[model samples]
Target: MQPTEGERRTRLTIGVVAARSGRLAKLGDPLTFVTEHLRRRLRHVVGQGGRYELELVSRDSRSDPEVARRVTEELIRHERADIIVTLAGTRVLPAVADVCEALATPCVTSAFPWQVHYFGRGATRTRPFSWTYHFCWGLDDIAAVFAEMWAVLGAERRVGCLWNDGPQGNWSRHRERGFLPAAAARGHFLVDPGGYREPATAFDDHITAFRDADVEIITSAATGADLARFRHQAARRGLRPRLITCSRWLAYPVDGTGADDPAEAKVASLVYWTPRHPYRSSFDGMPAADLAAAYERATGRQWLQPLGLAHALFEVAVHALATADDPTQARAVAAAIGRTRLETVAGPLDWTTGPVPNVATVRLAGGQWKRGTRHPHELAVVSNSHCPGLRLEADLEFLH
Candidate 1:
């Protein structure tokens, strides 16, 4: 099946891997959804005069780290990937960071907070040497949003925090350091009931303790179906505390159904970058209706927050590559990203990082479930700082 002598081929291979456990179904699952969206976007970009080849390698990391490392190595060394994009958290980041560093290639990771420092720190130190970019929010930003939510609810005096016990969870631990003391100084009590792993079948046990402690609010670092189950179980048992959740939670469907829930429904979420409602914005220029239509036509599904974020990331990446003299060079791409200021669906993004007087730039906004709508209750700008680094603390209490 080889082509004749004069046939020319220009191939640019990019590798993508997901660290989350299990195989992907066509719809519903977060990893699958993200991966498919990325694939579609990549194809569209390529079709629009961008020549590149993209391949996705799915791996199961639940069993062993060495297995994940081996998969990464194969992609880089054997597959000869020009760039490696990982949708894994700490599990894969630490394993591949050194390899990418040694090889002097770019590694773009879509990880939560705990892994941010691993990638961010790596990116900062190895800049122009080995390029690393994190496409997720920061932990400090999460903490700040929690503080603001508690303050807004007038529950600043006492707060409780709950997180999973993994790489993402570890980032929550670091965030508490900055968040708890800030709350305490504001005459609030900070409570950490350790960390709980996902598939939390022991709902009764956790709720009992929070109830006993008279915890007014409970903030969680969990997301997707886990958050829905947590809320449903708590509500059924009458353990409704004021609820605050991480940005990941915000991406879930508001009603626990595909459509939006009623406005009276209660499920508070913290997010980075303001959510694009069906409204107008001068910065992006793309009207809400136009963006929604474009997204629906492109993906064959209604647009949501996560889709918006993914689209924005893809747009930025395309822009960076399009304007580069050598699009395949990792260093050139990184430099382009850092220097270019582009408008995206997620609003304006300045990729450059540096210490400034006002490091607490607003990153996380808040949202709630609307009882009966396709979108979550219109997202609101709560805190003016990034939610990832903020010590997030809030409780979900149902009002019956």
Candidate 2:
């Protein structure tokens, strides 16, 4: 049956998913966060514009590719989602990408760029087809930043890489192809003693291997809970090295309080970035907190990581819709997005080529865990290659 115009109002839904694994029990999941944020932002944008509607559907990928594909099919065919936002790293992104192409809908994702590349071939002639828009920083850019930081610190020699053996691990392995050779050319000894799992049942063997390598610098790609557990274990066993980790480390609240032992505090200085925190003081202005609070007020639970990404996703959707000449056409909306630049609470976001979106600049800063504060040593931007408007140090305050 063909539906009337009024009946189509509720058809626009957004789908979200998270891993349902025991390993991620402590750190809040990303799916929940994205869902709540999307709902909140949709309400705010709708209230002001009164155009489209937003719906949140939850799926559990368990990091499995098949599960991801099934969930995406359900969302597109059953839920009638106008747009889909999938949190990065789940097996679901590729599945959703394929479906979005078949359905001609747009899918915005927050995941490692390399994962997108590994999942399949190009969908778009101009960009990767399947109408996928990436919001996360690319691994190549991350590796380059790490290399730059190592050079600045004068600790470019004796580098060791460690990552969990999964999609992220596989991506890191590819990243090392470029990272190692770059470091080697700079007079550094790069070593891959193999990756380790987080919340690992055993670490004695991994610890022994790291010690034997006598590595001065270690780059880690781990989530908050995993990194915390590994750091705690490393501290307890006196396994200390200058550690460099991915930006995911900043996604969680990192107070030294999370560490059981006081000795862990000593190694905190080794963390890297542009020597400044990425978060802006204006984060308080971000609609995410307001949305989270509203969700709590109604549902009595706080939103988490994935929800944050969802909120950003919805904001992007709203921007695209507002600027779009015709919101109902998927191609038109995608065209608008390509032509527009979104000013988001996370920073100014725009899409570019590569397997993943390129981050023209990284807001670098560092922080330390201090009493009562989750982040100390607040981050300040040392450089931003992409953000031409933010070249001066004083202009960085605008990021807040």
**Highest lDDT scorer:** 1
Question: Alpha carbon lDDT of residue 305, candidate 2?
Answer: 34
Runs in model 1 with CA error above 4 Å? 1-14, 18-75, 86-99, 114-129, 175-187, 203-209, 224-239, 244-247, 254-265, 272-292, 295-302, 323-325, 338-340, 354-362, 375-400
Residue-level lDDT tens digits of model 2 in 1-400: 3368765432345566455553332222545554554455454223223565555676766566677677777776777665666654534566666666677777776544443343333433345453656665445555555555555447555666666666555565664433345456567676776767654655566566667877656666665566666656766787776544444554433444535322233222212222121422122454444544554565454333334444556566666656666665677667665654655544556664333332212223322222322223223333345333333232111100
Give all TM-scores, in the order shown: 0.67, 0.68
lDDT of 1 by residue, 24-84 (tens): 1111233445556456445522422457554444444442446657766777777665565
Question: Model 1 compared with the native: what TM-score?
Answer: 0.67
Lowest summed lDDT over 10 consecutive residues: which window, candidate 2? 391-400
Alpha-carbon deviation at 359 in model 2, angstroms = 8.6
For model 2, the superposed segments whose C-alpha errors exceed 4 Å read 4-11, 18-67, 90-92, 111-127, 148-155, 175-187, 197-209, 223-239, 242-248, 254-308, 352-371, 374-400
